[model samples]
Target: MTTPLGGAPLTSLEQDPAMAGGDADSGDAGDLGPQPVVNRTIGRRHGHHGRNWMGHGRRAKSNPELRGGFDGLNFHDQRYANGGNQFSVEPPDQGLCVGNGFVMESVNDVLAVYDKSGNELVGPVDLNTFYGYPAAINRSTGAYGPSITDPSCYYDSDTRRWFQVVLTLDRVGTTSSLAGTNHLDIAVSQTANPTGAWNIYHLPVQNNGTQGTPDHGCDGGFCLGDYPHIGADNNAIFLTTNEFALFGSGFYGAQIYAISKKALVHGAASPNVVLFNGGDPNIPAPAFTVWPATSPDGQFAGARGGTEYLLSSDAVFYDSGTSNTLWLWSVSNTRAIDKAPTALNLDVSPLTVQDYAVPTSLVQQKPGDTPLRDCFALTGCAPTYLGYPNIVYPTPRPMAVNDSRMQQVTYANGKLWGTLDTDVLLADGTHGSGINYFVINPHSGGLFANGTLALPDANLTYGAAAVTRSGRGVIAFTVVGPDNYPSAGYASFDAKIGAGDVHIAAAGAGPWDGFTGIPYLAGNRPRWGDYGAAATDGDRIWTASEYIAQTCTLTDYLTAPMFQCGGTRGALGNWATRISKFEL
Candidate 1:
């Protein structure tokens, strides 16, 4: 078993005797320099491994079969199988692959499980049949009331059990849609063996529910919140009470919500829970929960929250051009989330510099625009320059992470490897076109390397889908080509190398390749859901279309061709589309 750093303990920066002094820029925040990466793996690991068995890819060539029977001819809108986003857990040793599954349209959308092997653990079982989605939403406001939906799965080595925390929506009918009467469901199961029975139990919130409104903004509509994240800490599932924010519009705010292990999941409700709520105008109403570690120096210290919730700031509110920053809160324990002085508190302390005066990548200079520095590698390509973050310092910097984006600022391998979107620097250097890739250390806010890939003139922006980190490399992709045309999803790549390691080639420069034949996925499309597909896991090597699910071997990705959200009939109505899984 991969043990957590420092026994996975929780420590507060506020409680740290040595870390008490200095501002975020004091340059003394615990040697934020790049240290060798100890754990080669990223994110939580999983268990329960068996042999491999191949299964034929779903062969239905029609859209009806691809879209789970929804063909857009009728208003066959199916609410989220459980009103929550998908849950994922990667195996420790076999960190190369991860397991991800969601509550789908069955048994009232009971949660299901899919691991690295692409086998369904829950295998056609309704999550509700085992647990239940007991919460509701507020009709007028579209706010979610209490009853867990934020389901997070973790492997417990101590008991060999999988722990899940359901974050219940707190407002009845507050956010009504086909996605089940707006509720959260956190259930626990011990499914170590694929063919074994699960010991499933639904966890509960204190006082039988939440105390505040559905956390919908006063104006309502798009400015609403949902999607809670739960983590293990202090022997409890540490939850954040932050609002779930709508993306692109870029708004943020949420607090810590906690649930105890002894309560609900263990069949008892004790010690009222408390939730943190923050007030800010530019930002939407804070989500009712945020994941918090009791202390900063503890094991959970320097660890980033795996999930986020936010209130959409731009949709309902008029011309708030500013992208709202999602505020976060934390709960020390589940049972005391709503009742303790320390339960719901802000995670950012020492008043870290709110504005680092850092320019968005859209306004930064390109590495090529400057001189070649750092390390560089070349193929048949021309000799180029490689840069490093302008400076190096030690202070925790604010980086937003979500299902849409996985941002990390860590010191590893004795060289600070900062990774972020290339678009942030394009507008200033390259007219915001082509592949945008950069490496900048967050601690010092320095620009290490900034440049575009030598693609065959593909206008790349953040449209390149998702960005994820592997061993010592960074991978990002986007749907590149004309905005209106069925563009190709191009994957940009780069990796850090050790000096003593093989200097087979230059560092940043390499032969550019493509994951050819990645056709534009045309199916059920939503305004935002269709924007870009999410990567299967943190490896970020490949991103699968939302409509497609692969077979057991990860050889091919399959889906329906007629996947449409609001548009009229087409493939979104009845055609299935499958694509070969090829690396770029």
Candidate 2:
């Protein structure tokens, strides 16, 4: 069974291509002529609170229309391998930060706090509770959350604070059904210690002219701020997101918010925020996810009255046709947010570089589907795992390598660096998935250096990079193909020398056996992690990526462990995450 790219599961309300700006291939924002949007909003301080502990999210079944996969298996996730009630969600998007002795990481909805020595300080807390919201799976009362996805956190040494952001959809009361309204919940730690009290601010992006959000015209309905990211300078904190219709149609450009970092650090009531709308998702050359660059040293470029740089890709799928154009965007006069009259400006210009196209879905090699002859002979899966009714062979699914969008961007060594998933020519001259790592001088808007790292047989996808003050860094991504399972990998880079050879940080134990890609009827595409993360400490860089940690035979999966597959993975999926730090 082969699942088309768009065949991945979607919610019943806004699943139509016509309604959600089509799939990765269809939303070609044709020629968005360089018109920078300028807008402003005065966001009120929602409140500040603390909930250091997080209980497990309930696995109760909700609206099947909101989730997808093999539900008959009673897996929390069905189609797209998305978990409805349980915390066993798919595509462990890695969001991490390492600074001031604390290593903070958030995968999907679970947040884990670790010390610099790799000790788990705070283990597996749900984001709902972290944000002062009601727990999704309340152990005592058995209540749960609406829907929270795409989490990002930053440890700013400039202000000695920890910032965490996530995209949250409005829930209908305390139940599982969605309320069709959404906002960005930004939390700031009062002290350097992240487990302490946190101040929370709510920035609504529905833009239907409600909830203090300006009317940006979201297909005549509320908009969803999908994939919110974080970046900061000495003056402010930048949060960017891709706006999509919550209940209606069309995909808008990237929505950018510039918040006063000082105000948040000082615990001021009602910090100022300037909103930059992506402008008309249906118009020509619509912007996708424009990623903001995080600064590690707190040393920012002192040009154009303090600047916060960003990078974006118009490769094939995002531009409708093939494109080699990379857009360089910046927010000038960012310091003006503190004054009564703000002079913030959004500048978007294109820089030509290596041509890139939509990449192929990653393939994996695992011992899942054996010969039917062996099963009939009772020598293989006939006795335990598959012999049972409703149990079937768990064939490795094709990892969903979503559209070619910009990955993490960072500022270091007076240069802006970033990554993007794109088609590359391998040593064999065949097209394969790889990353285009790039560097820019933000001042002159120049493409200083770049390289496309690819393997002869293996495909590299979901690139994440972090650079120190001296241009020492690593580009982290996942390696998978006909010969390799899903594994965590990285490459070293220096300003003098480009990216080095690919090194396996942690080898995958098995192939991708998640529910999203199981071969049932028209087989589905297992979505790989949507994002990968890397952060800098002093001379070391830390990275977290999705990899298969263990594999079990059919017989061992169903019985003794009571369907947890030897407690190596979730009950339904075979995905795990690995974090590794390299001392340069």
Candidate 3:
């Protein structure tokens, strides 16, 4: 779920405010430009939050017309219940990784471990428990603990270890004033077995405690790191975050933390930390949230050894359909984290891609293949009501395109691969949410191939991609609209065909009505989380997505304030994250 920053419209590409700096040395050997400083203020800390916002839902009528499509594929799906009605909100911000004959999947607050045969071995427990904290405590402390949102994980084959990252936040208004603190919690599995022990570490991100003092890498202490993404190369693990102020008011810039992977895997008491931000002397101007790229084979063996790559879009806000530039950053000397690490802004021709806008309203129709009417109360509309009485008809909420930040990135076969969701103008002149991907030559900073995947009358968003050694890859994503539920699907890709035909991995069981407990919008807003996960296990591609599983759940929306729909609500639904593996 994205923190709403105000209703201000996105600025045009020409008026983008963050584009005012000059180019620095492009991380090539010997160019050895300026090095980033070490931020020693970061270290381990601990606490636990007792209460959390476990969201609510709306009733959805299953539309059969939206049920089945494009099932012809050579892959088999074995999906078990990952997380659903018993836990968090609409879309469970899903995270999954497969390695060493085990599967680890995480939602907002809980994680489940599974064997290679799709059988649960342990967990479905709160993150606090897995992080070695007491389950019940005051959640308002301005200390380090697992707020546990935006969970991302990676499995390193070289070290036979697993790593996961989540944001830790102080309860809103914990201080006398409304200020709070934010932290990043990191965990590295002690062994290949995820059910085993883990080395947990925490780093301070923002502290709004001081009214006017500037925080470590922001204009002030009010900065909060939202939407954290984790990735790794052979030498180091990188975490990228989009920094915002309290209540989601201001956008500062992206923050990158490069930690020594070897140190973490070996249980070092203290690992060196290198922090990068827009304020850094070596970073280019107008930088936003740059996504750190993960190695395709779980190890970095590219032309530039010991280097990690980062990618970002020039557009800051969503619905900005004019930006055409994608920025690339390379950090070298990662293995020597104890010493200075060189950060370079690489020069590359920005790939020319289609611009996009906010998606329109989508409908979850009635059962029996019936079409949904724009107004359910109108005459001759089948099944009188879409879900229940008093439910808003045609609930309007834009699909999650929270900035054009890269969703998932991979480094394979000496090339970089990445994809993101955007509102694109199709060749047929229709505007909808589609997936845009790029394959780039990292050394030359040139685009080898790029394309957009958009279905004729469907909307696609929240996409993740995984590439194999043979240049074969698969993209996993969610599709939803009036003619479809929130379904999970994928498409194969190769150097021969950029992206092939769409195949339905799992069609949603019912309609995704809306979420509860929000302040301003009440029960109509849909929560898609920030992103999904895609990984490769040497020969196969593994993916996960949040899809609607149950359409009707009992919900009490009247318990919250500002809700237009009061009383006990039925037809509320739950999200079941699907994890599937297929050959590419």
Candidate 4:
């Protein structure tokens, strides 16, 4: 089922003629103008507790089940359920690519390919095999090689090529510490067919001695690129990463890497790389996780070449104060990347937005269903036939919500669109998790329009959006709370106006898991995945999310048979992914 391809080490920058030039600077690189002030708050409210859960221990005295606010518009339809293989434990970390009448979906370590009709073509294969590496590796010391995680894929219509990227670590056991080498592996399809041979490139990610001195804000001794996101324009491709100290000791800031898209797609032996850090002299303090936005329709309608943009939220932690500013970075002269003695220009700018508080835990409950107090104790009534010890009600313990970060972004129809998870004030005066959608004028650096979408009692988080050439767009996100199971939902909107009412695209079959605490999870919370994905193929928008399977079956925790449950070597059904196609 798998093969071993070993690892590819970083090539010497000097040996590569394309990287001979000195780094470029835009107006003294470090001297950015004064920070952009918040023009005005779009969604403002009071009585916000940083991390409050209203339904933690109390049951409703008497009330009907709460439902989402619907706009009465049904312009979207699910074309097919291209169910993905179960791969990762919690928080599925899903990604999707659809183009040329084909679809490809990837979870943490597994990838699957299908036709437009949802017919399986190839794969359900381990990421290692596809990357030319051993199928399985030693978990403790990483004997065979580093384990692959956090994969993202994109389809480039201009060149008819597909790109897949993943982060590889030395060993699976040392996740909390940066004790071994780390790498970001990139694979570009040689032709339109994804199942055929491909070119693989690896870039070292750890802060080793050879990585050059880090910027002032980076932890020089132990830097690792965590949560790498991918985006692209016609002239170049971008990879944004959150640089962190090996053991999560310090947050360094975001790292943006630019590569030649033309060179990669053409099968060049070695492609030149340009790197940018937010800390240098521009965005000095309180800046982290700069997410790069990719153009959904491929490069903008601009008349210029070699230009790309990135965005970041001033606030990092969920408990941090409400943020009213967004940092923007523009990299120009990217066309010079492959030419020696030429460098790219980088600029950083900050813009003010409406002050928004950090998101709080969402409540999801079924009618007359008492919340499970102790899932491990097996003392509560079960919803599905799986019986007790299943994932507890409200799935994630303590009802924690995702942080406010731009989950996914797209550039289309002369506008940049993005969405993030945030706490919103409902019409009834209740605070709930909701999606914040905002648009920006890339050319003028102005905030175009922004609004919030929240249901009465439901919490929505981990959202993704895509836009069409006609200025029509759709947003896909997860809905969960005390009144509902984790479900996949979406809202469509006309870019000229705003998003329509919420619609449940696909509902979860049951609770995610019965275990309240697990080592892999952060603080024993149910892993709802870092983010979902949405992309447009010019006419139709495709969305994907981590959803629960309709049936229950035992599954391994992570290659260990002893970790099974319910008298099976591997019991406890895990979360699965679903890919759906729709039109606005």
> Which numbered prediction scores highest in TM-score against the true structure?
2
Candidate 3 residue spans exceeding 4 A from truth: 1-87, 136-146, 171-179, 207-220, 279-282, 301-305, 317-320, 339-391, 395-403, 425-430, 516-524, 553-573
For this target, which candidate reaches the highest lDDT against the unseen true structure?
Answer: 2
Q: Among all windows of ten consecutive residues in candidate 2, which has the lowest summed lDDT?
A: 65-74
Backbone clash pairs for candidate 3 read: 1-529, 18-286, 58-572, 59-571, 59-572, 356-423
Segments in model 1 whose C-alpha atoms lie over 4 Å from true places: 1-116, 124-160, 163-182, 191-225, 240-252, 261-272, 280-299, 302-345, 349-525, 528-584
In the range 188-238, model 3's lDDT, one tens digit per residue, is 998889998888988667734353324644444456666688877777889
Cα lDDT tens digits, model 4, 30-148, are: 21222111010112222275532332111223212112111110001010011211122334477788888788887656677888777778766667777776533333333343456
Q: Which 10-residue window in model 3 sums to the lowest lDDT?
A: 14-23
Error of 2 at 325 (Å): 0.6
Model 3 scores what on Cα lDDT?
Answer: 0.56
Clashes of each: 117, 11, 6, 23
**Model 4 misplaced stretches (Cα beyond 4 Å):** 1-88, 136-144, 172-179, 211-220, 301-304, 317-320, 340-342, 365-375, 379-400, 426-430, 514-516, 519-522, 551-573
Kindly list the per-residue Cα lDDT of model 1 for residues 132-213, writing each as its tens digit: 3332332233343333322334433223334544433333233322221233345444343323444443222222123333
Candidate lDDT scores, in order, read: 0.25, 0.65, 0.56, 0.57
Candidate 2 lDDT over residue span 436-491, tens digit each: 77888777777778767777667788889998888888888888866778787788
For model 4, state the Cα shift of residue 60 in Å: 26
